[model samples]
Target: MEVRMLPEPHTVESYRRSVLGLVTALPAETVGLAEGLGRTTAEAVTAAFAVPRFDNAAMDGYAVRAADLEGASPESPAVLVRLEPSRAGSPQPRPLRTGEARPVMTGAPLPPGADLVVPVERTTSGRFDDGATVALWRDAKPHIRNRGEDIAEGAPIVRRGVVLGPRDLGLLAATGHTVVRVHRAPRVALVVTGDELFSDAGPRAGIPDSNSVYLRAAVTALGGDVVSVQLVRDDEDALRRVLDSAARKADLIVSTGGVGPGTHDLAGRLAAASPDGTLARVAMRPGRPQAHGRWRGTPWLALPGTPAAAFVSFEAFVRPVLARLAGALTGGEPASETVSVGWPGRAGAVRFVPLAVEADADAIAVHPLGSPDHASHSLSAMFRAPLIAMVGAETANVETGQLVPVFEPA
Candidate 1:
């Protein structure tokens, strides 16, 4: 196979759009609410019933007509005969009489003809008992929680393409939803290619294969199911076989290593030879050599061999595509943070500087862990920093106290 020359490097924004354009949302599947966490909804979910199904008491008090305590006070109290007690989960009590009061507990359905609830503390006899005379010192406001106050019946509970969280599940449960329809998680296949890598525990001549572990964990954390993880040597024929097998088993194929310009970069060579693939450099620090396109009818992303570059490329490119396939709608822009210290940047390449974030009530700031140029071998620094600061390609250096876009590490 003939090796194609690498094309001009694409900007981060243009490359992201190119990859995302090729993705289509996965099919929807019905799942129980118990298994719905982190799943993206395929359709909008509306409330089956109104929240607070019925008008209920907001406090433990006496259900009474506001007019009864019109002139009530401590010295000249309004004495009213108490009827039956009203507890939560019990049948609705009879309509409150004009000169009578019914003792009520919190969350109990309000009695008919009662317009106000006088807290028990404001009454002389602060007790829930039948046939008792209670003296109210002052008039109290109606402490009733109205039906549909929180969410009205048939109102939208969650919009389409929303990732279900713990609170979302609780709301769905409370709104009478036992099952939800959500997009299926995308199936991913990982290919870690290299000849100088070893997976054994003992000291070996080759470096330990950390890419397999990192890529697997990253794919899982992004809601993609890792179907297979294959480590292939630096051989074109062997790489082709693994790619063919991976295409059949996964929706997307992610390969770490062997995408650089080195002669032993078999992944990059094969990817460039494909009729539908594009192998180009990305204008970014640490991760410049990148290849992506369809291979054997499966989407393929070939990343650099360097650990830091692989990580940065995955977060910048693969993550959004996976989210799209899972039907998740994410924010367009990343949140920004102020820099606590100055850092140098690449002249014509975008800089993804690993940072240790410090957030407080006063301000949120970021401290650079290490130099961006040396990020390829700074795996320890990457581990210490959970956030990546994005500096524009036009900027040569970021000054202290400057705001920069920041994103979470995958």
Candidate 2:
């Protein structure tokens, strides 16, 4: 019998740098506001016109000249003749002379020469009607939203590298933007290896391949397009064919399973045979066996076959690369939240644990969901967790109530 040994595992940071170094932002494309949700801006979006576009009333009120309502109060009111009501989208009413008032609905353009607005509630009339005159108890307070108050004309509404959200879209639309230039989602090719992994099979038969389902959703959430998903049955030729075909259609390639030193583990072997591929053990439990290289100029990443390992590796390593390719401003770090540890665990190497976080009094408490060991780890329980707790590689043990880093799956 012959024995084979792999080299020392690369540090997590070193592996991440290697993977991110090979990725670049995808090309920019124009997308309408409806389609730009969660897309990263390729350039700063400048406002074509100021928010509000013109001075407008902020509430349903009476637009009046402040000079006309001097000394007006609940005890003694000011009587002013009302002109036509000024509704939104109607042309701005003609300039108001002294002793004149106009019913201004919320968002209605302030009539010219009207310096202030008194809420209809504060006036004798609770609602605006075609009234001949109205009595105002409180003096006008000028409840007007001025032009450019929220955003200035020609000013940047959204900066480059920003991910567009619902509020961002609303602001852009308010600033008169119909379409925006955004970095296109990077197309990803998923290659799953191993003959035993099946998508539909009883537990007694073989393990279910749930990686594809979660990986596809994760890729889409991270702003990457899954162009191809290939399952190879521990065959060198099949892996090669899929890689070759995937390279032609994808910007990046991700393979799950068959990365170990076993004879049936053909994924690592095929990748090592590539023109620019190398197999290395990363310094992390569960996901230490990793393969990286370029297949037809597209970056390829291989993760451990286990569901827990694949999920953790995607969050720690693959997700940052996707963010880079998608033009998100992650700075090589996954989105994280501070959490207090509730249990102790082994932490010689960087460890990732699916965690369920809860609010405990004034602090956030995190409970590790399942075992860290690859075989005993629970995939079903992990799905219920909202966060992944990352134990530092140098920290030997996690102390109770100690603050730790928790990451939300993108």
Best by TM-score: 1
**What tens-digit string does per-residue lDDT give for candidate 2 at 1-410?**
12232477788888888888888888899999999998999999899999879999998888998889889887788999988888899887899899988988889999889889899988865677676898885543579999889888999879999988999999899899999999998899999988888876555677778888889989988778999887778877878899999999999999999778898887776666565677878778658888777888888888888887888888878888888888987744545554455555565678777777788679666667666454126776567778776777887666666666777775
In model 2, the number of clashes is 0
lDDT of 2 at 21: 83
Compose the digit string of candidate 1's lDDT tens values, residues 292-381: 777888888888878888888888999989989999886246889888998765578888888987789997767888766677668888
RMSD of every prediction: 2.3, 3.0
Model 2 is weakest, by summed lDDT over 10 consecutive residues, at: 1-10
Model 2 off-target regions past 4 Å? 1-6, 71-76, 122-131, 137-140, 201-204, 331-347, 359-364, 372-376
**RMSD (Cα, Å) of candidate 1?**
2.3
**Candidate 1 at 26: error in angstroms?**
0.8
* Model 1: residues with Cα > 4 Å off, grouped in runs: 79-81, 130-133, 358-365
TM-score, predicted candidate 1 vs. hidden true structure: 0.92
